[model samples]
Target chain A: MRKAIAASAAVIMLSIGAIAGAAEVKMVGTVQKIEMQGGAATVTLKDTKSGNEVKVTVKDDLTLDKFKDKRIVDGDEVRVKYDDGDGVVTIFRKTAGC
Target chain B: MTKILFTGLVAGAVMASAAFAKDHPGREYMEKNGYKGPETCEVCHPGKAKEFLSTVHWTHASKVDNVENTDPAREYGMKNRIYTMCNGNDIVNNLKEIPKTPDAKGTKFSGCNTCHPGNHLSDVGSAGPEAEAAIDCLVCHSREYDHSKRKPFKDDQGRVVLGQDRSVKAALAIAKPTVKNCMTCHEAAGGGVLVKRGFAFTKENDVHAAKGMVCVDCHKAKNHKIPTGFDPNNWAHDGVRVACADCHTETPHKDAEYNRHTARIACQTCHVTRTGGSFAKDFTTWEKLSNGYYEPTTLRKDANETVPVYAWYDKTVANRPDFIGPKGSRSDKASRIYPFKVFQGKGFFDRKTGELLAMDFAPPMSNGDTLAGVASAAKILGIKQYDPVPGWQTVLFGSNHLVTKKNALTCNNCHAPNGVLRFKDLGYSDDEVKRLTSPELYLQKMAEKQREEW
Candidate 1:
């Protein structure tokens, strides 16, 4: 019973660390296009929240499998999650190829 | 009728005068007709000719005629053909063979014209060394034409045209010998050039042999002049040292230091002795047992025991007892004294009464005449011969000991980029320059990668 309680506490700490490390970036716009090359994926995301458009690149390993095949184009509503690290990564509903 | 006949007579006289003008030898004939005879190009260029001749360019040229004294041909499929140059006074002593007719093909002699044309032999009224040299450049380097031996092809007119041997003709047409002149003959003629194969003329095949390197970079004549020399200490040869390590270093034995001692020993020293420019040797076969194969020979504890056995062998065998093979089934106890395994030292073989040999060495067990001992080692290990690998050697010699019988230079001694061939006379390419630069690094990298898997 004591070990189980300790394990739950460790999980709670890891979740809090992940949330602290992440920052919420809000951009609502139409999807432009998605593309993949050299193990990196680029998603053209237009801001529906800010009326801005930007293309973000993400490591191929970080993206979900369902998003892999989704076709993205201009003027389509979409949601995205991303990290700004060495380069930058933006996860989208669809990529440039889709 | 009388007037017409007079007019014809006048016309005929004018035609006769024109023919006379055309037939007569004039100032042009005097300028180009003949040689001043055998004058050394070195008088002006100093070391250029000697350096150039040492290159694969001059030494490895195909269609080299006027080499009257080569040894009897031994190569397979070339029966009665002349290969090596004959020794001694074959020309003076064998006078009966004099006034000899050439083989089926007309004789082709070596000269400046063999690679460089025009003033190389001289063309009528061709003036200035620059003019002569310029024409030579046009023939060889221009992609608009190819001087390589022609294969059959169709002309723009859709007529079949056979390519002639362009080596001689192209040089002749150019009217001068240029640095690029030698490439037509040097780059792609199989073993004729360097006694080495796998030379491709295009940039994709060999980026360097194509660029700047030419024949004179390595070879030298009676006098050494071309490459002033490179610096291991002083930093010469345009900043590159002209030595074997300049291009290659993978030695079969462990370590460069060990190889330095073993590599200098000629193939014939261990594997054979000179037998009229060839070795009188044999490769013996051994009997197969359940586990391995065995050959008949005495086992010697050391070099002292080997001497007596060799003495007896010299007296009994028709040929000298220089070559050894892994043979088996001895009738005499003395014959069985030195088994083949003893010669290879330890850990080179399996412990058995009889076993087939195999070879596991680089440069492969080819060149039967040169590396017979290495081949014997491979055969004993039951190793089948594989595609031969290319190799380079470094030769450090004692003052008295030179590399080759013809000249003191060894194979790698003069064949690399920084040798005498680097002088202006013999042109080598840039890619060869890069390849010849760091053979040691290449060996190191190969060993490192191999260790990863091992």
Candidate 2:
């Protein structure tokens, strides 16, 4: 019984570590397209540094007020933070304004 | 204890030296490189420095009397108020109050350092006496100055760093101001190449440049006062001398009719045909960054050869206060036919007030605020009700450069009834258009010629 309890605690700690490690990944790129559907938005970015395309889906809970007076437009330089696990954008920031 | 005190004293001395050294790196670099700074030039060229200081380049703003000479400030009013990006601080004014700190939004004004070497906008912390001393004498005199590594000094917050570290080595490269150097700022004026004056000035396109004649050959300057005959207020000034007739004779063309047209038509009307290239147009919109500096985004360009728009310019000013006749009509004594580049674009303005809102289209919006939309732009301009004025106005830019002598317009180009020259729009009477374009009129002239032959 004691061994089983210790094994269960170890598993819980490992699961927590894995959850912490799955943090969001930030990237700098140019916005290729922005598709808004209902309460969600999917943005396609062409990475300026790597020249690779990245697609990030933004849910209703995503924060985007950082752009201040500017709106998200195609071809704008943007810095995006996304969940590494689901590739969902959590923060959409316009980098060109800076 | 003794060793610690000695170390502390040494460190303090080093820190003090570093602070003092940062103030004048250009001078130190010149001393080390065996090249003399502006101080050395001033010793020998004091007269030239004094004369240059009086010129418009150093003053940044030209003094013009107001149409109504009632205000004292009118004496120092700018000739081209649209290009007044830099506040009056850049002008060598004794009475003007200099700002204690650089503008928060990193707004750069066209000042003395814009054309003068060794002077820098980022290093404006050393403005008064120190900046005057650091003038790079070799920028216009030496043939080796390289400003390739120069970059805008910005802080970690992305705001332009005031009194930040500059690359001393980058500023030391000396060179005589060539056509390339002059174009460095001029080409970028009004936001980049081919945007301002509509002259696509390239080595291959410019007729005089192709002939190996430098800008100074025609724009002769004495005491640093360059001749610009376009300004009506300054036209009578003794410094205004160079004109088309100065170089090209009155009868430049072999045809007598063409020679007769010179009195009413500007030289550019026949010389400049079209301008613009693939990399010529910059339609990029600048967005404010978090740090208060604006960066270009939504970069777009259109490469197309645009024909020059002909106008009636009285040779006094490129853009006069009153409206002239239509495109082809030359009626007024103060007006003659001239070619111009008509720049069309959309902008925002106050609908209620009918005033054009000067948005922070160019970076460093007057206030250190970010203009993200109509609301933000209105707030910056202090407008209550504003709307986007799409395709509102067409700006007229004088097309004087890019002369293609081979592609000169023929008589039919203008004389034909439906020719490029819109005679009707130019306020010409219907009778005049009929007489100018009528085939029967040509037949009558031919019949008269035949009778003379008989």
Q: Top TM-score: which candidate number?
A: 2
Predicted candidate 2 versus true structure: per-residue lDDT over B1-454, tens digit per residue: 5436544544554454344334333456455654545455555357565455545555444443322222335333222232112111222211111122243323333222333333443232234555556554544543333433222344565443222112334334333244544654454344433344435344456766565455555666677677765523232232355766665656677567788888877787787766442112212244443333443332222212577667776654422222111222366765667766555434444455544444433323323332333454355446565654422434455566787766777666677787677778777889999877766544555576579989
Tens-digit lDDT track of model 2 for A1-98: 99999999999999888888787887878778877766666778887668799998877331221121123556666667888777887556544311
Clash number for each model: 74, 14
Candidate 2, position A41, lDDT: 69
Q: What DockQ does candidate 2 have relative to the true complex?
A: 0.03
Worst 10 residues of 1 chain B by lDDT: B307-316
B1-454: candidate 1 lDDT, tens digit per residue: 4435544544554444344323222224324542121121223345443343332222222221112222223211111111111001111111110111222112112111223222222221234443233233333322223433332344576433323332322222321222233344432111112111112222222222233223333322223323322110111122112432322232433345434533333221222111110111012222211111111111212111121011111002111111222221223323211101112211112223222222211111112121343354445445465332222111110110011223222323323455422312222256655555445425664577579969
iRMSD (Å) of candidate 1? 29.9
Q: DockQ score of candidate 1?
A: 0.01
In model 2, the runs with Cα more than 4 Å from the true position are A1-98, B1-33, B65-80, B83-131, B140-142, B154-176, B229-241, B277-304, B316-329, B351-353, B360-391, B438-454
- For the record, the alpha-carbon RMSD of candidate 1 to the native fold, in angstroms, is 28.9
Off by over 4 Å in 1: A1-98, B1-114, B119-135, B140-182, B188-198, B201-243, B246-451
lDDT of 1: 0.29
